[model samples]
Target: MLPSCFRNICKNSVLPKKTFGGAFSKNNFATEATFETKPYRLHKLDTSPSTTVTINREDAIKFYTQMNTIRRIETAAGNLYKDKIIRGFCHLYSGQEAVAVGIKAALRPHDGVITAYRAHGWSYIMGVSPLGVLAELCGRQKGCAKGKGGSMHMYSDNFYGGNGIVGAQVPLGVGIALAARYKGTDGVCVALYGDGAANQGQVFEVYNMAKLWNLPCIFVCENNGYGMGTSSERAAASTNYYSRGDYIPGIWVDGMDVLAVRECFRFSVDYAGSGKGPLVIEAATYRYSGHSMSDPGTSYRTRDEIQEVRQTRDPITSFKEKIISANLVTADEIKKIDGEIRSQVDEATKQAKIDAEIGLDELPADVYSQSLEPKIRNVDPFKPLVHKRLGAAVNI
Candidate 1:
């Protein structure tokens, strides 16, 4: 379906670019390297020496706080999963927080976003309550899903997500953009998917529709290199996932650095919002966790390789280093933020554990219309699904 999607991963190679060793102009950082086929580099399109897009100290601190919160929350989720506190296929966004936090930073409140099932960070960044997310993990009623949707199927206002079916959200995002256009609204829709989902046929279909309609949409491929344990090299014939959209202008971004990601997605949002049709961004990120909590991330790649990426390209640490080097923040300030985030996560987990009132009637509450009509029905018998069991019946 999505091609053995993330089964065999590319072994991490020594990328020539350093965390801080890129060519610097007045405001842009550029680097040259051969990757997959084309030359890879970063060009800051909107940076100007005089022009100010300066963020306040409070805002910078907040960005760091939120990102650290996401990291701590996901790490706690992993530990809880190991202890069986969280059930089901829980995907942890331990290393990919930069993509979500940075992009969301560039977005307006009304902008829409959708991503694959590895969606905890996106949800948290989109203002989904940390307690709610943790409660969902705990299967408590206080979760954003009210305990019905454990790790996936999470939704928040303008932030749709945790979609389980591979590539299914591509068309859904197109529909969201279509609705935005029909309403004559300026809201942009961001359709995010994994490298694995990039191979899904529907993604191309939606891209075609989006291009034809000139919809205000930005398609983001968070190419964390692997779909589950499978690497893009093994799964994709062409490793450059950004150019998959032939009609749209595509960009490759360093997803490890929040500022880089924010700049890139900001450009895409501007392009799409300016009626330039849809823009595609391939964010080259890496996921520290396995596809889910159970995969160990070791079956397809070596521990040394994973450690190397972590030691070399960790987004949070990279950003922290930049802030310190630029004198925007001190090391003590970062450490304080880290401690605060950990405390917040710990408190959120405590509240989530005690929030038992949420899940009691969630299943029966949202089932149908005021008339209580069933959303689906099965009239056919002798079908394999029907014969299997009533709950197991196929809707189609």
Candidate 2:
């Protein structure tokens, strides 16, 4: 709708492209860009994460690879569950790959992450390989939990359990932060929970305690629109979860954008690690699958809505498009990564299916860590066992 003169100026590239860095190269694109993707809203904070995230060939490759690997893993998990290869409650992290990948990109080795049952992506990011995750899902001995704890329980170095309880991990997150403080090591615990668990009384109590004790815990509420089949509107009075922490500072970010989410965590790591007490972050994200394998995701929401989010706001797709559009990487490179991941996932799934389940005798082995011998220490099973004599299942 511009006038002829302005249209001519734009078409001819006569106008100076001096806005971003220098004038656009002869290729008509800037080598780098800042302030791409969505903006973040802050609460009770003077500073924000860098508007421009680091964009280089290396990071672009890593982001696409990791995020897509997570997506593929979740997709494989869904298929496995449908095929009865995976039993028990299975929560897929298909739509929210960016949150975990971004956090991984920004995480330090000293930092710890604890999350709820929707932890496939976090588990991979926190050091468990895709093979380990799939093996765990399939109840194989090679799982991060050695198949003892299926879908809802996986852990690794510096990564806590994939707690089955709704909001229980928040206090454990505080405990981790308190330990870090006590040991004088600057470790921040990134605790994640769903919006459904946000309203849990225990979450608020720990929030208060974390702030009171100046614990370095980053409490993240992954608001993926619907908590199970119930929408957030029906579940919580106020959905502005970022500001839910009144006393503690909060930040809201576009969870669908990997770069913004990365910057959000980068800023958070610096802030919380500096003894800034706790932080509350509401990552506005979406979940393509149901809350668990039991709930059909389409019951409450329409197919069109999920389709729209997939087309528009999908973290993997959007980030891929952005990476290509920015010329950081090529479509061929993306395709190559896709193929590699597909092969990797297929191999992992094969292994997970073939791997043997833990034997009954081995069940008594990990009762305590390998370091602690049971006879010398004379310790009963650390985890309590309720023995219901169901015809004497086995004689250990």
Candidate 3:
């Protein structure tokens, strides 16, 4: 007994009945399909000679589901912001879903990730649930950071904060890589920054150290054409960000193509893990929305330009076409997935709106270790608020 949408999609769909290596072979309600891997042209780096890439049923379905979920979640966030449910600096990851999905596909459970403010997609891809992300944006106690970290500061295991500062996450990512190396783990850290952050002096400094120490790090520049309101052309003197690493090897990729991104990141992981020093990847991507909810996003770029990209190069649409053309999944199945994701996002939004806000007493709890009690400023200048250090109970 299913709804009309579900019944229709499930009726004609061919689900795999046999098991492959003790795992079900069903792929999003369709037979497993594989496509020839498209050749990706790399910049200033040796192209992976391997000609073909394969998309297994499980991975294909997972990628599609995750990418769609991110899109829907971001759309819900934008709606919540418009309705005043979310406050203070909201950045949507509408068009950049491919990058997050692709990079995450190449990562292991122990691998770490850090990124800039437009990080809702990364947070979800890194293991934070959609509910947690929506709740965090809404400033609810059920949020990933317990409502303290808003849109720009959600954190989870192995995934660092959605840093508020422009280029600060770059160094923090290096630190995480250093920790992984020191701990004798094969884990690598992926540091993501925008094209604007590429010009930061600190990023270059970190590059030098990463090269000198041969840190297991991948410095990624998501070149989404524009940096906030200004286009990359106006902001950067030389637009070739991949080559900016100087001594560090670099790879430039088509960020809009998720398969391409996944391939490149796989190569990067191998490169860094093999002690080949750090590799910089410049992803040529674009964002459909403005820098933030405040910006109209139409002042600098023309409406037609955006429309053109959406029509021709949209990541999600392109992938969907590939899946269908390869007979991987029917259009009805994809539509069903879209409907399910939208419903899930809607439910998460509804729950986040009703979730309780964080209390004032809990504010000082995470500030310091329990062993070192610190006084926090209250309304009264002399009578400061004091709380037991969190570290006293357990090691931080």
- Give candidate 3's error at residue 211 in angstroms: 0.3
Q: Specify the highest-TM-score model's number.
A: 2
> Where does the lowest 10-residue lDDT sum fall in candidate 3?
1-10
List candidate 1 stretches off by more than 4 Å.
Answer: 1-56, 357-361, 367-396
Alpha carbon lDDT of residue 240, candidate 1? 71
TM-score of each: 0.80, 0.88, 0.85
Better model by TM-score, 1 or 3?
Answer: 3
Among the numbered candidates, top lDDT falls to 2
Whole-model lDDT for model 2 versus the true structure?
A: 0.82
Candidate 1 vs candidate 2, lDDT winner: 2
Ranking by lDDT: 2, 3, 1
Model 2 bad stretches (over 4 Å): 1-33, 370-396
Please provide, for model 3 over 239-312, each residue's C-alpha lDDT reduced to its tens digit, 9 standing for 90 to 100: 77878888888876667768778988888998888787788887777888999999989988788767867886
lDDT of 2 by residue, 1-396 (tens): 221211221243311111245435565545664444445668899998865665665687888899999989999999999999999899999888988988878889999999999999889888888899999999899999999889899999999979999999999999999999999998999999988999999999999999999899999998887777778878898888889989999988877778878899999998999988999998888888888989888878788877877876677887777767766667888888999999999999999999999865566656655665336321244433345675433424
Candidate 3 error regions (>4 Å): 1-44, 47-51, 368-396
lDDT of 3 at 68: 90
Report lDDT (CA) for all predictions: 0.73, 0.82, 0.80
Displacement of residue 102 (Cα, Å) in model 3 is 0.5
lDDT digits (tens) for residues 1-396 of candidate 1: 122212112132323222333444443422221112112232322331111124434556777777888888898888878888898889999888888988998898878998889888888898788888898888888888777878887888898787999889888998988888889888899999999889999999988999899998888888887888787878889877767888676776667767666666666777777787887787778888889877888888887767876786787776666555544567787888788787888999988867775422234455442445543333223332343555664433
Error of 1 at 317 (Å): 0.5
